[model samples]
Target: MTSSDLCATLDESDALRLLRGGQFQLEGRLVDASNTTLRARLTLDGVTARCVYKPVRGERPLWDFPDGTLAGREVSAYLVSQATGWGLVPPTVLRDGPLGPGACQLWIDEPDDAEALVGFVPSDQLPPRWFPVAGARDEDGTAYALAHADDPRLAALAVLDAVINNADRKGGHVLRGPDDRVYGVDHGVSFHVEEKLRTVLWGWAGRPLPAEAVEVLRRLAGAVAGPLGAELAEHLTTAEIAELAGRVDRLVEQGRFPLPPQDWPAMPWPPI
Candidate 1:
């Protein structure tokens, strides 16, 4: 659907309301609407937030070269976020259109005024051997400080990605929430083949998955047939749901201490 059509689908009332007057208050620019994702920000009320507004464009891309449809990606992101709520993703606030972007979302506030590191790396710098990317990390040296290890949080995030088939878990996408609550973002490029995981956090590789992490996945499994299951069905096909459910079961069978798959890449390159 076109951008305007999305607004009607969400039922957001027309007539824009003014909040502030400056750039933060004015229309937000398109942040990262790429082959897999689209984002925009605008000041609706008094608060300023960012939104990665993705819509279902109906039907998946037939070509293997990889072109993502907005709607499917969005629905998958929302369902996974809702199903795996442990601060692993941003919530799909609302589905409206004709605002700043074609879609309206619960704007994700930046790390509570803690801006990203001096230089947060992007995902493109991943190992050229894994894929072909030259001159990726052109600017080197302390551009950004990396997240510390021993932060039990990244372990949980790794588990989440494994279950969701999220190939793109860039380091920068993982957020340090209030009270050391770690969160993961940008799941639009998830649940596809190519084992797309490109995260930079693997300090705990081969580590036994924690009990709490397993429980979370198990809980998600239980909900798949009920709340979570129903929620996902709207966006994905029945077969996809089955696959997701099956994956969760595999994690549960590991009994909270499954070792990281050795075959998996050590970490996402460029270390984003």
Candidate 2:
């Protein structure tokens, strides 16, 4: 999508107009950042925060991401995270349209200072070190996956993201919250529900499936026949939903962690 694709044409509330600039001053630590967006620790109105700011550039959108202004992308991520509870995203500080058709979104926090794996996620960050690569480990020899996996809410997020075809659920995008829970960040790329299932989650490739993981998939399959499936249908087509269901079934039947499908050319850097 391009800047031209963005404008006050959608049936959004007046907030769309006020989304082009800042509503209040922001001050905080430069916790961590990336080439496209910067996150800082911030506080406002007696609340603590993590701020994310994206500066628009060029005649074309830099990342082949949706041609939304900063505010549009942030708002979309926040709303989707809230709806799905996968927590793989950032919060919305504010959004408003700008001179002509520009806009921006202010993010209040960042769980870590690392960028999401762009392409060919290195070996060190793969599972058990995060998959395909090695880095960190726990006593049972697992690479310390999301702490929220035990929570039904978090599991729902994984399932929903899979259903939505989230293309960037990499290690860095999942943040470790202060409560020691997990949060997902950087959701600008999501909701396609195609064969874009590239991920580092299969580091244990070829290993027998864990019983616990099986439970999560089962619960998701059950939900798919109900509210989850119904809701997904609103944003995606019947074919997309079937494809998503197929993915889950594949994981279950394989009965073992699968390896990254490096068959296609790697997703382009910047993915734009």
Candidate 3:
């Protein structure tokens, strides 16, 4: 089936089943990825969809994160997203692929005319409801500002990034799915025990948390204290899971969005 067909017919549970049990065939490599990432087709019980597969053996070692753990972190991000009921992440699962065990996530196809929610805009012409996070200069000396929309969907993702300690939420990582949902991808560098939150979605920093977000956090607190925490333990360390819980509680208590970190760079390099 085509991606649109799959999106129309399959719900989250069906997508999860296909990701966990489907056969993967590598169609190509995403060369721009820092680690090996394969674009492939997943098939099971005559249902087929495109998926991105990142094999554990192909993961590159990072200085802060443990080696061979990125794939699991990707899955963990999905779980947290699922728990939020925000559906900000595509369905993802850790399963055996052609190369070995890895993360298999249902691919989201963006529409051709989908406007970017996070990107560079002319320095002096910030769009209404858009917030600027940083400034930059082009090779020709033109000025630009890194920014993102004030939309609540993007706000939900920003909160998710904070809880996951996502250290690499580049602009390119945000996609507007054909269904019009805001989805975040490339979460392999997340869930570190350290305070490594970095992203392009700092527009809502220091603002009051949206009421919807507060309700989600309340549910998330319970989930973390119960079954969701157990599911995460399979992919994250005990310390990391504890830290995740702590972050959520603090957000609930503070009742506001987190500010950019003072020690770490507030945004990831190559913001787009």
Top TM-score prediction, candidate number: 3
Model 3 per-residue lDDT tens digits across residues 1-272: 79767866789999999999988778999999999999999889999999999999999998898999999999999999999999999999999989999999999989899999988999989999999999889899999999899998899999999889999999999999888889999999988878999999998899999898999999999999999999999999999999999999999999999999999998888788
- Candidates sorted by TM-score, descending order? 3, 1, 2
Q: Give candidate 2 misplaced runs (Cα > 4 Å).
A: 1-48, 51-164, 266-272
lDDT of 1 by residue, 1-272 (tens): 32222322322222122111212322444444343234455444343344455443422364422443334544566566556666555445335443332223433334456534212334443322222111233355323333434456666677777776765666567665433445676565556543444455544555567777777777788888788778776656676678778777877786543333467654455456
Global lDDT of each candidate: 0.51, 0.43, 0.92
Candidate 2 lDDT over residue span 54-81, tens digit each: 5344113535344543334344445544
TM-score for all predictions?
Answer: 0.63, 0.49, 0.98
Least accurate 10 contiguous residues by lDDT in model 1: 14-23
Q: When superposed on Cα atoms, how far off is each prediction in RMSD?
A: 9.1, 10.5, 0.9
Clashes of each: 11, 28, 0
- Quote model 3's TM-score: 0.98
> Which of 2 and 3 is ahead in lDDT?
3
On TM-score, the stronger of 2 and 3 is 3
List residue ranges in candidate 3 displaced over 4 A.
Answer: none
